[model samples]
Target: MSDVKKIATRDSYGAALVELGKEHDNVVVLDADLAAATKTCVFKKTFPERHIDCGIAEQNMIVAAAGLSTMGLVPFASSFAMFAAGRAFEQVRNSVGYPHLNVKIGATHGGISVGEDGASHQCCEDFALMRSIPGMVVLCPADDVEARAAMKAAYEHEGPVYLRFGRLAIPVFHDEENFHFEIGRGEVLRKGSDVALISTGLMTAEALAAADELAQAGIHARVINLCSIKPLDEELVLKAARECGRIVTCEEHSVIGGLGEAVCAAVAEAGVACRVKRVGVNDEFGHSGPAKEVLAQFGLDAAGIVRAAKSLLG
Candidate 1:
């Protein structure tokens, strides 16, 4: 992956906004004084009139987006994940989720990937918070291609959307032209029967690498990229559980209420005879470090996925 073309999903989010802005006159962007960090500044640079800076007020920004949505404008509220999802959870739920507005929350710097930003800035519980909201669509894209495509999809989606993008530049594994993306649909990168490696966001890259390692160890693994978290692709998950009989769920977020928990609920509800293991940040706060080192320290990397898979297989 080091040799592969790397791109941060936040960068993709900003670029996608510019593209959407060009195509739709009703498209507008609002940032909580983090345009540069969240990459929404790129959209601001191109369309200054359409970009609104709420001056570090994440909750106010979310409410404003909700208001703008009523005016027939597609408003994207941009901020750090901690502020957008954690701090503004109340406003998002009451204003956007309650009304089912067509507002998009572009939450960047999600999970432990915030690295040196430390625990306060890292938002590991965003999925749980956002998923709890009725009619809220949660999406965590894997790479640059999917992030841009997700931005387009979020713009088109009728109800509220929460998109969590990463700060770290991860491997650009998917081809832009060849890949196809749909909401509530999981993409299978590799197929095997020994175990299913399920993951979302940047962890999908790690899962792909882990599948290769598992193959070397004679434990063929199936790699499923679950980008849509809330409306999870339960069919693909059930199929994997039925075929592989073992599942390893991974994410950059906490294992409690993210991809892991979603898969567990799906498998349990389907009554599949499968063993599921979760590989992610333990229910703990993150400390300051380089992004890659922090992820490895928390066992959110390829080796961690392989370890969990092997344990489940054994």
Candidate 2:
């Protein structure tokens, strides 16, 4: 493995939008007065005509994006995860999800990693909200390369998609040239037989670090990045459960209705015999603090993951 380069997934999303703008003329972007913060400003600068600022009305922005999709335009509605997935949920569920329109919701600043933004801005329930919508593809990319690839995949996909991005700068572990990104496939970064550390979003980086720490303690860990939360890679998950006999799910979001729950549901439905443990915010809200501090406080960091893995293994 090479030295990791740190980059925010939101930045990757912005760059991907610009590249998509050049590739597809039908691609349009809509932001709810948070273009700079959500990194949609890059798209606005590159394709001024294709970008639309919808003021602070998140509901109207989502509805307008749904309308734009009806006109055969692939609309990417960009905003903070809280507002996009929480505030405009009714609009998204009714307008886009109900009609099964080709609208991509680029929700940046997802999870408690929003840091000083506090509970109001930090969205930890986006996965729950997005996953509840039928026919909606929920994707949470782990790093820059996956974020870029996910954006492209969402654009090419025909149905509604909710692409979750983060504010924190995470390690970019995947090399774009050799990385394989499929919409519903989980990638195994490490191979081990003791325990499988399945993670999503920024938590994948922590899982990798925890794997290294576990190795030193003579506990081999298999790290799997479940980028696609909805339409999850059930095959890989069950395979890991059956082979490893121990499963630990880590995510920046809540323990409920997130990656942890998804893994549990998959394993239970498949009747996979494995002990499962979750490492995430334990059914609570976020507070104002530094991102790393907040993550460590909630046991969503590497040490936390290692602890969870050890507990599960025992």
User: Which prediction has the highest lDDT against the true structure?
Assistant: 2
The CA lDDT at 242 in model 2 is: 97
Question: Going through the candidates in order, what is the number of backbone clashes in each?
Answer: 0, 0
The global C-alpha lDDT for each of the candidates, from Candidate 1 onward, is 0.93, 0.94
**Which lDDT value does model 1 have at 1?**
46
Tens digit of per-residue lDDT, candidate 1, span 29-87: 99988899999999999999999999978888999999999999999999999999999
The C-alpha stretches of model 2 lying farther than 4 A from their native spots are 1-3
- Model 2 over residues 1-314: C-alpha lDDT tens digits? 45668999999999999999999999999999999988999999989999999999999999999999999999999999999999999999999999999999999999999999788988988898999999999999999999999999899899999999999999998899998888899999999989999999999999999999999999999999999999899999999999999999998888888889989999998998999999888998999999989888989889999999999877
Highest-TM-score candidate? 1
Candidate 1, residue 209: how far the Cα is off, in Å = 0.6
**Which segments of model 1 are wrong by more than 4 Å?**
none
Q: TM-score for model 2?
A: 0.98
What lDDT score is found at residue 188 in candidate 1?
Answer: 90
